[model samples]
Target: MLQLAWGLCLTALLGWDSAVLAAKFRRPAAVFPLPLLCAAALLVYAGALPGFLRAGVWGGVGALGALAVWGALRLGRESVRQLTESSGLMLFLGGAALLWVVLFCLQPMFFQWDEFTAWGLAPKMVVQNGCLYPAQPGNLKASFTYPATSMVTVLFQPFARWSEWGCMAALDTLAMACLAAAAALPNKRRMAGIAVFAAGFVLPYFFADTPAGSYAAQYANAMADLPLFLLFGGSLCLYYALGGQGRAYWLTVLPLMLLTLTKDICFAYGLMAVFLIGLDLWWAGDAPARKRFLPAVAKALPLAVAVVAAFVSWGRYTAAVTPLQETAASVGSEGLSYGAVLLGGVRQLLGIGREEKFAVLMSLMFRAFFTRRVCLLGGGAAAVGCITLAAAAAGCGAETGAARRRVVTAYLGLAFCFAALYLFHLILYYYNFGESEALALKGYDRYLTPYYQAWMLVMLALLGQGAGSRRGAGALCAVSLAVLGIFAGRGVPAAGFWSDASSRYTLRQDVQTKAAALNPALQPDDRVLVISQGDDATRWYYYRYELTGTVADGFSGRYTEVGDTSQREKGDFMNLVSPDNEYLYAGDCTVCTPETLMAYMQETGCDYLLLDRSDGYLQQAFSPYFAGGLQDSMPATLYRFAGCDAAVPFTVAAQESGVAG
Candidate 1:
């Protein structure tokens, strides 16, 4: 409940200025609050930017809090009423969605590997040190050089408490804001828009079989993907409004800046949005091809510069601090030519239609737009709808030749922009993964969620302008609501209610609690090295990462689990830091001798060893070091290095004599 209150207060505080400014520029009322929220997040980021120090963040939040209170008190009766009505159902849906996030957060089930290690760890270190730093050896479970957005997670850390709830609230707020933006389509057929967006966005959580997979799986985890997608969707809407209504599209710089600050992949998305916005501005009118283009270019230059500057800033920081892989290393040794990769990518895109499994992907995307599955049997239906809608509008015989041409150009331009962005994304993916290997296309559909939403918005605008009658609008709205009701009736629960024991909720809160209780037994400086057999050490990482509250290290059966790309040097370094089961620490003996194991312990400076008793390989390899006793719920054994100094000198002397081999 406190989290909900804080979320509302923070939203109002941050949004008031941006909303009022957007209103002055005649931006849509629904989108007004969205920009304000982003503005608020950016403001908070600015505060954290002075070396990302904690004191700076407090000062910024304090000032923003006072401003928010002042704004609330000064809202005139008419202004208050207008704000209330403008928010309407979108606010309710957003609130409801947040409730689900809160429920998951309470369970605090952080199942995604990247979340606990990469996204969650970055902000945590910032909170602990009061500033951002490079990923150190002891804490290299995640990508060290990803980018700036992970630090934004720090905003959710309540009073710098390092609570999971705080991080959950921050991410949920972003996700909800995005949904609200999507729901804020033109108020004409507004109910239909709300129904469609609410159902499509919310239903995925309840139904496990969704084509993009379970929506609940995402919201329930700590990944930044959902928020990033939503932010990208909001940016697309802003660009759509810019092209269609000619509002000050330059305000899009806010979303672009936020996007650059969030995820590495989104840097590319930010660039794509800027390019499309520039294109829209350049061709916005009925004037001769080049007359008004210069003015548009002048308006777009600042936004482009902002994105470029952000990219450069992020690049410089990572280059200085993070040991990220170079492009050549990322490409691997398979040596598939760029031309071959490009050709393979083209074939894959073209093959989506003929493939039966892609039928699900097409169906899901179409439903995202039209809501009704009746018209979404395959991609062919979408192709037909675009063609039919175009032909019907062309035959309306209602406008001058220039006007008709303009309409065609606008519809074609929107489609082309979406296609270009998606194709470019595919090309990049192919470049990263190579020809045959890229065919798997893992997580590709989820990544394209924003593009799907953009396509829907464009279709709506096309139908709104060209269908030429309220009847056509009414029919689409009705069909959309019907589809939405069918899904929402089953998926969304009563307000503030959630199924805590669903299949999506896999982690045990009880187990986590028990593990964390053990932390008090160890000293702050005492290092506990953890090892698990057969490569699955995900739960162990979460246990240590959350409970320890310090930079910690571990060994796993696989290097890939510890953020190793296809690089030998990194793998060797990891082996040196924490030897895996594969390493020969024991000579002739199946299990490691006390002397050899003691030397490893001394090298790592780990005073205690945490081993998974369930893992046979770990038990067989390290039984000599076992000091005894298992912990419940965690099902792991604790082994202490008793008088570790005795074996260390023996092992060192043996190494000096070349007998360590």
Candidate 2:
């Protein structure tokens, strides 16, 4: 089964990439994936392509780091004087490489909870069905839990390989590597700027890799989201990297279509990227950009499938997770801050905020989307970066045939989009989060928007060509280093994660650790169910989580769905634990085990039921049928619920009057 899984994933991945490669090789192409071959090679060298394909967070970091080091080594030796002149640049590269190594080395240590909830769970479903299929509860996810993207999202995983969250890291890394390579190859002066500033690669890096803090890779590891980030970011870089023509131009559009298909977030950035690409084309010449349209369209055809997939995925998530249960108020109420409000316009354009937060509510009134953490460079630095880059481009305008006006327009368009994405979030407080008072949920920063990096890199590229001086780049390398140093200095010590008081006790433990605890010894045919709240049980593949290294061929499952009407079907519900199964590890959610849950379980003939509600859902306000029966007990204690908690307590009350246990 494992070998077959590898065969499937390898075929799909190779077919997709190699087709493009074969096409590019057919002619003298622009920006070939050649530079990335080494990274791909390293991944192949590490282990079975499927293992990394299944769970390649660490693998990607290692691959990317190794490839980058190799790229630098190919730079040909620099004279001692030249090396000395660029000591700061060399040191920056070395430090970043070191960080990458550390990131890979400690990758296992930092993997977290949500990874299981979002990343790990989806792939498991894909592996089970042996293809992209609807995930049902108690196996992988609730019917509505996975968005429409689940089909391909699942397909992207090595088919027949029962793993979760693994493929997400791999796909995201592909996009990230492409984006970084594009950035590195750009003719901008800030090429070194983005490199040294370190913020340019933030999201793409962390999305495929991992990060610190509660929401660190929490944002990146998400299946659909990080891919969306890469699509948008990569498309933007592709426009600049493509220089308005050649095979690279075609490659740029594929990511664009992908951006649109990934998530609602892409609609905004996709527009920016496409528009920027158009501007690049227009500036390149009157007929040349238009002449390449066929090739671009042809190259982008496969990616268009992503659009169909995204729509299908969106329909699923909307049908399940947010249906009527998630109203404008509930979503809008998720976070309300002034930063979100004032930056409402910014948010809207960047696809970050809701209607309530948009400066003009009607602009995005019809659509509702929850935004993720978008990192970009910040403030005075952002503005100065743009101006300097503009100056550099302007200086070259006469010497080179590139259109300064078009580039500036693209930059400004990017800026406006970001500003809009930010402001939209600020206004969301009043219109969405119900913030009648001053909003303070911290909505309008670079971390929540992409423009920051766009702005930062553009500015840096400009500065590099204009003058490689540190202060000329704003706040000398030392100061910038000090700031990053401070952040790095805090390192693992400050990397702890936090959760709401309700689940704080249960969720605070390292996610992997918590998942490990739930792993039990079992047979090849054994099956398990994890009923968790807030991303608790992901990486629990009997192999990874249990790590008992014992033999087991059991397929695993999860509960919860993405959108509305997205819950387990009777078929999957019945298959929760195969007939020969022995154990189950559960997470918490008052939503589960409700009256409806009891019916589902009894119908499935479940022998044992475990409820490990993180924190305590014990005192939770329940329906009359529930509260009157079930109740809370010791902290972190596992409860056995047969019939119902309500029934047990009710039986106890009746027992006092002579009822049976």
Candidate 3:
């Protein structure tokens, strides 16, 4: 209920025009609430709102609700009649809402490694500390370079207080809904729009290669990529709308700003998108089109540029704080020429079958789609592609030479830019690393997702424009529905049909339970150091709340010769276990000694030490100072410092507050 209210409030505050535009078409546009909700959270985090405003985001929610109501009332009788005319659109909206609610209830809290360390840790910290900075210096590996807009927000913060993962999942629902709304924008074909919307929900699962399916894990995790789909895709649609007659140009501002705020790569993406918009404007040729385009760009570019500048400044800040050697680990030192890089990428692409069969198979599926199929899936995709291309060709023939030149220039320019960017990303990966090794990496596939998504939106937009005939729209609607049905059938069983939380898939509940058990003994400001297998679980350690900070794995420690980097002359070392990050340990030396370890601990100011069973060898070495143990089904042990109290009561209420993730 609060989620719905917050969505409504957000819609009022930032997306009133978007809601009105959707109403103008009598379409089910539910996306207006999401970005506005995100914007509200971001404002509070940036300290733009009054201090008193932070107590509950709901106050802003109420005000926004009132504003939305007022806006609706002003729309008058004609608009009301227009909205009520679409009974079919209403049914689609109702069904989507019900399915999303069911999915939200069935999903578990985040258990993904990326979720814990990369993105989730920051929000968890903000919610606990009531501020954004890391409480412990050792906790910075969670990538301080990451943008905070979607990280710590009201949705996940005070409102969904009990479930950290649940907050992430709710945001996912909103983002998915927005993407659907973008696909269903302004055109009158209600069923086609809903099909487009359903495709957004199912496509990610179809693309996911895991046996457990995308929904069982990926979609629910609090990551920026999913939201990127909505913001970037919507920006393109609005860019297209600049050529049309509407007030959409005004609505494009916040989503574009949010896009820049959401991720580092967005800075480059936004710049390129702006460049494309300008190129398209020049080709639009019509003086009136140019007039509309210029003013929209004038209003949007300032905010977009400011966001890009702020993101770059934050990145520079993170770079300055990191050491030279550690910085090398993040990016490559040897630069490859463009020719060599491109050649390497092509060679690697052809040789994909040698490693990662999934990539090869998926590539073939996509290839089959373009060339024009094995079965319904590929055939439907090919048919859709053919229809869009044929329509584009016919439109090209219908235009005068000057108009045709303009259309061709814009399409070719966009195609070239996307290809260049995608190649640049792939080549960097292949050049820095070996062929098969790069293929094995996840970054290659991750980049492809956005690349395909952008193209998919473009194709869908083109198809919508050309399909003025009822027969064409009905064909698209049928193919889209078939695609949706196929994915829904496959995804449900793979996701465990909503029977279990999927918490056990990653074994994170025990981590939460252990943290809860240790919370009462420590103050809100007490710092705890977790000695585990690696830094992957650091965010998991910090998930719910019990400690001021957690010291996990990092890259800045003394370099040692371990693991196989036989290709390189000198291998990099594992970061030694140092609390303060002052001293370096090259595998052996003071680590095994009791006095040296205790002195290091004291220097680091860790109030408590939590040890994973994987670190049993280190636990044996520190057995002389063993204070006590934690209660758990898992192999986790806790020991207090020598001068600390011997006994502490275990509190399970916090752990029990929310039933598993």
Candidate 4:
């Protein structure tokens, strides 16, 4: 039912956008891009409008009415028979891809702390309470930095918690479905466009993964990352399809904004969109081009204003009310040998850095072409068979120069857009880190996961062309398939992502079990303070991050001096600095010894003290207010502090609250 409704709503939205672009720009006879891009959006809109109105979305209904006007206009003038027939193949391919993605790769488990902070926890918080909670029952309290993704998720969460995931999934699926339908059109430009989507974003199935194969598997929300990535791509496609201007501009803005709200990574796409539009405006010539460009400018205007305003407001709020701090050691590139960094860069270019990159690339190639994994021994072969249809492009194409240029222009423009986006991130990392391999997570490949597959697919498609005349598309696909199969069989051994889960979850268990064995050492409501050897020990403090008042970190707050402090003085602190009174310890204070923590805790009236590592807390190193003795640091034990000047102002909460949603 939701699927059917979404299809109509999508249709209405796309149809209206197409009519608006055509009416404003007055494209010659028919614009292929407009129809190709706008078709599915129209269907989804048509399907979704009535129910959305009935649900008391007066504003959404108003938007629906406006889109319907455009839908009616487009339908009145443009013939759907050819367009529907033309898009049929792509629609089918995209739907199949959608099914494969939803069933196979996507999962529901919230694996990312980043996602936990932004989406999973935020909506959970918002639905249960009106305003955001500063912190849960566990540790420190401060401002909320959760991004917009939670707000988007929260929209459906209010009705019913169960409906929340289902709503998001259904809408995201519709977006994917539209993307697939758009790709199935019957022209070289259309096919190339489809190829762009295939290569750039969605991963080809890794056999017997999620929905396609087994149910109990590796992921919890395999559905999320891909949907947002495709939204970014399809939004771009829609922009170009609607001629990138006029009322047709809304086609791009609506999706781009929605994508922006999906996650922090996606906000980068919104920035990218602004850049692309600005570039288009600068490059375009004459009235027709201007017509397409201007509406885009207008459409993007609202977002541009809103985004800037929001940033400014948030920036001001943070600066005046709450400050967000970051570490230069982690963020900056200072001490590494530049020469070695350059060598590391060369290693990556030479396929030498981590096996993971090679493994991912190898896995992608196998998945794109063929899967020989034991999990998908039979019918999955037929899915790869569709690659055979793509070969038809070899024989069927525009024979004329003018026709080829149009097709080439669109792709070249898109390629340039991607190149610019990649270089912008790539150079930033290189400029800072020189050539650090550990810098991969700093937005290199992860931010661009959806688009990576496109590059892989294009390689295959180009290869397919070479083999088209002699071996036939089937053989080309089959051979490609065979290559992927072999790679899939061996890729897992190379992907070692869990190298760090060791000590953390396990040591946390040891800590908990050992502490539990010491029965009545602390009551359920009693506060236990944690002092890591240093900030690095926090990695082994996973249970503490959950925000139960039972455990507290002496250093989610406080000053540090363990490592080099050439850049960060007291002036460098970006956040509030109240001593962590709940727990006081000196585990491994490279710069801050037990002496400093004990006195700080004593002055703050903290009740517990723990010590580790035979190092001085630098009582001589700090003022008495900031120092204490750590001469007895060898015995690592948690002890009670009997003498304190005054108690902390706040009492610990009895129960720990789950994330916002």
Candidate 5:
């Protein structure tokens, strides 16, 4: 926890000094987010370059820190002024939010599926090995192609030890930074900024079906969704507030770069941001229409180049380090690559021969627009449009017309981008997932909610701009607080929120404890097969990550379905054996028998078998093969295949022994 505090302070200093240097020591009106964006961008590069070079990531971090220190020294008193200029309300709210995050993150466990597989795994690999996932030994099942931007965010500890709480805290800090950026609009009405900030803070709860139980649950895990959307939306807010002035170009480009580095799909959001910047520029200035076109293009050119560069560079890097089989473009069983599948999906979208899957996708997407929780784009746009028009009708000012036009333009632009992104996902899923999973539109909200969240922030920023006077702004602030209070009270329970968050990962914690106890008996070089009956295949990943020594080679459950016994041949199940296999369902077949099980152990070079949960089949059919009659422990059992012959029977022991080994 002390490590987390030090890391947070170091990151804050680096971010602030870097932003100050970038701004040439001159304070901007919307000062809070520039540092946040700068820090995120700096961390992305600092974390990434080390992986590409196979060097210590902390060395790169140290270099960045030194540079920030130099910049701060040069700025002198200006740095102190920059800190003093930040909004007190924004700071207080952000601090309060960070405190809540720290408490929630103190659980020290990863609850989400993606956390163990990709998001959490990637970072753990980096911190443990001081390099990328490719450099890690054993069969690492994480998506190696996935960018490490989010991974670096949580690397606060100096030692190689991984901390789940630290990861959550670091990421939640980034999220809060984004909210602060969005709220720090360049408006004279301080109350208006407060209102916008307050709204943006509680916006996640507005969604009916959040992935987690409570609002705090959203930030308690180390997933890329929350940070990606917040950064995307915050970039737009900073651009609008700063007006894309002299040093503001760097601010704009840095956040977009961070956005691009966040996830593969987020590159589109960065591109959309670039286009919107150009559009805003085109709408600004009273120059002739013909002259405005080239100038707008010229101004947006740097952002476009930066985004493209980030995207292409990361793509090339991942391609170089990652195997062809591990990539998203890997060929499937149908003799078509994922790229080919995407092209086919595009053809279906263009009115070529369509399938039932395509129809299902279209129906879900169309229906998503009407769904209250999903259609944040439409809902936010409506609210912004209505507010702008109402202000204009009441004779607020001529500024309302420009604000209205900007709102409409942004709405149409984002709506189109959203549709394109949805289509891309629909097609991508069609190829990557099973028919049922694809048709169900799994992770629909998780994927699309980022865009809506970002859109809402932008709408709030625009709304803040159109707020006429201090009186009206004060009223808006009061109303926003009232709404926020009501929603927060209903959405997050005071008594249960912390306890529920802390207790959410009790099962995972139990797994870790058992793994720690069992790890001493296992050798680092040994290939171990784990059997956890009636559990999800994903549990194998949990064991694989938790075990300090030996590799968790494969997993099999007693209740797994084995289709068509007649068609299966002797030793046919051996074909499924691989280091990469997440779960190998060795059903109640020939493989479960003593002789066949011995053969499997011999063939796979596995000398040890761990029964995480023992069942009837193990005791009756396979017990004699155990070298010492089931080396039992609390809640788990181990079997040694070294001494026992397949045909020999050994003494059986009680399964309920309270032994450690």
Candidate 6:
């Protein structure tokens, strides 16, 4: 709770700084997005400072404090008065924040695969070590080049103990801030704002009917996907709401920089935003083409530069800190270089002859856009209807009609951008992934969902923006409520989503509990080998995360060549194993007999063995090696191996009891 409070307080301070800074240049269209803007600024600071100084977390805190002090001095009585007058926006944000707090309390654990491997792990490392993951002395489990924006944003304070819930709450706060910016729209109608917020909030749930089920689940996890899309969509919505004026270039630059730094692939989104911004600028006035071109270039130049600078700086930093081979290994597969695979994919596209993979990808993407992604399709349809009604009501001569037309143009622009982004992913996967995975389009929805969600939010913003009349606002509200009802019926209920024990959340909770129990008996530098029968690499990742301070390694007990000659006939079956698995063989494999197991332990330098689940074969084969047999424990049994001989049961028990005591 203290961590959560600190996070919220820091978020408020940074948000105030952002608002005050923007107010110095031009009055913001609305103040609700200040937190998100500040978050972007924080990312820029965190990403940049590390290059020049190794001050780590203190450097970030110092930046936050400096910004806050500056904002406090600049904050005038008039600014406070303006903030007070915006009571409706304050209440909406407060309510959303409260709900986020409640959601974090209900489930503060990460259940997703990538959460432990990358998103969740990276931030925890930063918080613990006060430096980037690469700066730490260990083999990098997560990709070193993965953007640290999300990780940096979660660092609410320096020297504070890391809390998973706190990090999650911090992330949720950013998302809420982004969505709440919709209230700052020029449309003063209360119903229209509510409709927009409702649509954006429930947009992720719309994919529940598709392969990416349960937005609540996604929300609970600490993956970068949810926050990345929210920032992307929210930034565009705010831009359009502000009428894409020349003065709002700062808004475009900050968010674009932050978005680009959130994920490596997100640079593409930044470029897409730049294209849209340029388009908006071109269509701004009734000036000649020659006159508009220069102005558009001048306005869009800063945004493009910011995105490129951010991407290049982070790339250079990672290259300096990480080995080229490691980065290549993390990104591509089958020993292919990133560039080679990309070029090969392009060549395949150019010289395609009835490409079955291309056909499948197109078909899947079509279904995803038009049919499976009901929320996007429905939201797009509703946006068009609302814009049409607004245009018809206001007539073509009115400013409102022109704005609605621009909205239509923007929607079409976003569709084109989404297509381009999707094509890029398809091409990358075509070369990087295996034939089966590429054909099946594994993780197809996960890859595209963020972009789709972002596009949906933009569409919803347009719908709200065009809700000029009472009747139009009413229709928009009706559509939003209907969509919400469909989400509730088909998706996981928002209220009970966290409490679903049948989900991966429960399994992770169990892993965490077991790790907590075992961590006490183990030393910080202990080398622990985890063995969980019937489990995969994911379980080891959980233990690796939970065991913190200890070196944890493990095998995926799911499959092994063992006594199967047919499987052995397959050349190098180990090549098929996931790189995530620390050890290649299962506990019960033919090569895992007593003497071989001891040799394996020595080879890996593992001093402790944790049987997360033991089979009959494991018990019979290894029990004789332990002098006092396996130390029985809930969820797992611990075996302490000291120089190829098991330690006495009593000594281990005493240490465990002492730690528990």
In order of appearance, the predictions have TM-scores of 0.71, 0.51, 0.70, 0.48, 0.81, 0.80
Order candidates by TM-score, high to low.
5, 6, 1, 3, 2, 4
Question: What does candidate 6 score on TM?
Answer: 0.80
Task: Note the Cα lDDT for every prediction shown.
Answer: 0.50, 0.38, 0.48, 0.38, 0.59, 0.59
lDDT per residue (tens digit) for residues 1-661 in model 1: 5655555556555445334433354444555555555655566555544465555556556756665555556643433443445542346335644653555355454556676566766666665655554533344422333434444455545455565545665666666655555555454545544543553354233222244323345454456665666676567555554443454665577777887767766676677666666666666467765986887677678777887777666556555555555322233255565566556556666884244433444444435434422122223244336334533443242234443554455456556666665565555554565544444554554555545444444334333333234554454454445435644554343222233534433443533553465555455466765544332455555655554523245322322222232322211111222244445432221233334445555666776654433344334443444433222223444445554554322211111112112
After superposing candidate 5 on the true structure, give the runs of residues whose Cα lies further than 4 Å from its correct spot.
11-74, 88-97, 139-145, 186-189, 208-216, 328-339, 371-404, 466-486, 493-500, 521-526, 549-591, 598-608, 631-661
lDDT of 3 by residue, 350-454 (tens): 674334543553454345334422222343254345334533542443224434444454456656676667556655654565556554543544554554455
User: For residues 182-279, what per-residue lDDT tens digits would candidate 5 score against the true structure?
Assistant: 65644345666677777776666543354334434665667888778887888887787665667655667777787787886777788999998888
Winner by lDDT between candidate 4 and candidate 3: 3
Candidate 2: tens digits of C-alpha lDDT, residues 1-661: 3533432343233223322332333321113332232233333222322233334423533444453344345432322222223322233333323333333333322144433344454445445543222222333333223322333333334345443333433443344343343333222333343443354444333212124443344322444544554456545554554555554455554455445544444555666665555544554444566685665555444445444554454445444543344322122444444355445545555666444434343333222122232222324334335344544443343223344454455566666766566544444534554443324443333234344444444433333323334333343243234324533553222232121222332433443343344334222233333333333234233223322222112112333332322433322111232112224332221233344444444444433232223223323423233323333432111222345444452111111112123
Model 1 lDDT on a 0 to 1 scale: 0.50
Colliding residue pairs in candidate 3:
108-661, 109-661, 560-573
The deviation in Å at residue 535 for candidate 2 is 14
